[model samples]
Target chain A: EPEVTQTPSHQVTQMGQEVILRCVPISNHLYFYWYRQILGQKVEFLVSFYNNEISEKSEIFDDQFSVERPDGSNFTLKIRSTKLEDSAMYFCASSEAALNTEAFFGQGTRLTVV
Target chain B: AQTVTQSQPEMSVQEAETVTLSCTYDTSENNYYLFWYKQPPSRQMILVIRQEAYKQQNATENRFSVNFQKAAKSFSLKISDSQLGDTAMYFCALRGNFGNEKLTFGTGTRLTIIP
Candidate 1:
């Protein structure tokens, strides 16, 4: 089965540094999303992207975060300056449609900020 | 806004036994979707099963089945003949049928199938 793939299974960055997390969604999927899960907490939606632009975003998705479909297959999330509280597991997901379709998730990229 | 609640934080069942994880959600939309996802120690999210809110018939996949009560806004996952491999953190998620592509997830329930 085709699955979403994320680069750098684990990443460690210093506070105030920048980090880019990349994902390659399923080829046919049109809707892409980014979610965050702090340790022992529920997964929270960060942003959703469709038609190469952000469709919606949550309050947690502030100025520090940005997502881009930089290419035909690559979706990337960039953090301008990482904070210690930014440490968490970041998941990239994609779906064939915006509604009534399962959003397949990647293995997740564990971001650790020191 | 939609909210999924998994009241049970942890549960354990003997191997080959049956286990049920409870989930309740609050949504004003009549048309939506519900899902059960499994995350093992590997920490990979796997979709175990899904159910459509409009459909009264529950969804089942092999040993995994769901008891969905639309009126009560409840969706629970039942794992029959559970094996050691069934041990994982189960998450109940909700998504609206229109205008929203994001999934609202519960806190998750840690299930252990003891040998």
Candidate 2:
């Protein structure tokens, strides 16, 4: 089955440095999303992207976070300044359509900021 | 704001036994979708099953089934003939059928299938 693929299964970055997590969603899907889960916490929605732009974002998706469909197949999340608290597992997901269809998730990128 | 609650933080079941994980959600919208996602040690979130709010008939996928109580706003997952491979973190999620709505996920239940 076709699946969303994320790069760098694990990443280690210095605090205050910039980091960009990349994802290649399923080719035919129209919607893309970025979510994060802190250790032992529930998954939190960060942002949703459609039509090459952000359609919605949560309060946790503040100034430091930005998502881009840099190309037809690549969706990327960039964090300008990483904080210690930013350490978590970041998941990328896509759906054929929004809301109605089930969203398929990638294996997730473990971001570790020290 | 919508929220999903998984009351049980952890649960264990003997191999080949049946186990049920509880999930309750709060949503104002009438039409929505509910899902159970399984995350193994690999950390890959896999969709186990889904239930549409408008449908009264519960959704089942193989040994994985759900008891969806629309009126009570409850959606629980039942895993029968549980195997050792079933050990994972299960999350119940909810999403409204409206525009640009993101999925809301529960804290998750850590399930262990003992051999």
Candidate 3:
């Protein structure tokens, strides 16, 4: 079974520093998304990308956050300046279609900002 | 806007017993999708089961099944013959059939299958 793969299972960065989380979605899938879960909290949608552009984003996805499909399979999320609150588990997901299809999730990247 | 609610924060059941996790959701769209995801200590999100709002028949995968009441806006997961490996956090999620493909997940219910 093909699955979304994320690099750097765990990362620790200082406040005000930049961090890039990488993900390689399933090759055939077109829609991609980035979500985050704070410790003991529900998963929150940050942004969704399709057609190599952002389709939608939540309020939590502010200017500091950006997502790019750098290549055919690589989807990356960059945080220009990390904050203590940015510490959480980031998940990458992809789906074949925008609706009715299940979005497969990656193992997740745990980002800890000190 | 979509909101998924898992009322039970935690639950425990004896091994081989049956356990049910409750979930309710609010969505304006008539057509949508519901899903149950499992997260074990490894913290990896695993898709367990899914249901289409338009389909009245519930979805079942092996020992995992769902009771979906579209009228009541309720979708619950039932794990039968639960094993110790079934212990994990379960999240109920909702996604509309139209624009915005993002999934809205519940707070999650921690389930423990005791030996």
Candidate 4:
């Protein structure tokens, strides 16, 4: 089965440095999303994208955070400057459409900020 | 956007026993979908089952099943013949039918099937 795949299953960055997490959604998927979960916390939505534009974003998705689908298959999330609280597992997910469909998730990129 | 809530933080079940994970969601949309995902220690999340809001009959997949109540906005997951491999974090998610809305996931319930 085709699945969403993310690169660098683990990432480490300096507190003030930048990081870009890359993901390749299912080939035919139209909707993509980025979510994060702090250790021992609930998964929180960061942003969603469709048709090369962002659809919706949560409060946590501020100026420092940006998502881009540079090409047909690759979707990337960039954090301009990382913070300690930014340390968490970042997930990339995709679905066939915006409507009633199940979104598949990647193994996740564990970002550790020091 | 929708919100999913899982009340139980942790649960334990004996091997081969049945266990239910409680979940309730709040969504204004009439048409949508609900799902249960299993996240093992490998950090990979696998879809366990799904329930369409329009379907009155509960959905089942082998040993996994869902009780989807549209009236109450509740969707719970039940695992039968639990095995040690069943030990993982179970998350209930809600997705809206409108727009490319992302799924709203619950905090997750850690389930352990004791041998």
DockQ top scorer: 3
Docking class of 3: high
Native-to-model Cα distance after best TM-score fit, residue B73 in candidate 2, in Å: 0.5
Which parts of model 3 have CA positions greater than 4 angstroms off?
none
Clashing pairs in 3: none
lDDT of 3 by residue, A47-108 (tens): 99999999999999999999999878899999999999999999999999998789999999
TM-score of each: 0.99, 0.99, 0.99, 0.96
- Write down the TM-score for model 2: 0.99
Encode model 4's per-residue lDDT on B1-115: one tens digit a residue: 4678899999999999999999999988888888899998887888999888888999999999988778888888999999999999999988777763677889999999999
* Residue pairs in collision within model 4: none
TM-score of chain B of 1: 0.98
Ranking by DockQ: 3, 1, 2, 4
lDDT of 3 by residue, B28-106 (tens): 9988999999999888899999998889999999999999998899999999999999999999999886675789999
Off by over 4 Å in 4: none
Checking candidate 1 for backbone clashes, the offending pairs are none
Q: Which DockQ-derived CAPRI band holds candidate 4?
A: medium
For model 1 the local lDDT of residue B11 reads 100
Candidate 1 off by > 4 Å: none
- Of candidates 4 and 3, the better by TM-score: 3
In candidate 2, clashing pairs total 0
Task: Please report, in order, the local distance difference test score of every candidate based on alpha carbons.
Answer: 0.95, 0.94, 0.95, 0.90
lDDT per residue (tens digit) for residues B1-112 in model 2: 7999999999999999999999999988889999999999998999999998989999999999999999899999999999999999999999986674799999999999
Query: In model 4, what lDDT does residue A86 have?
Result: 98
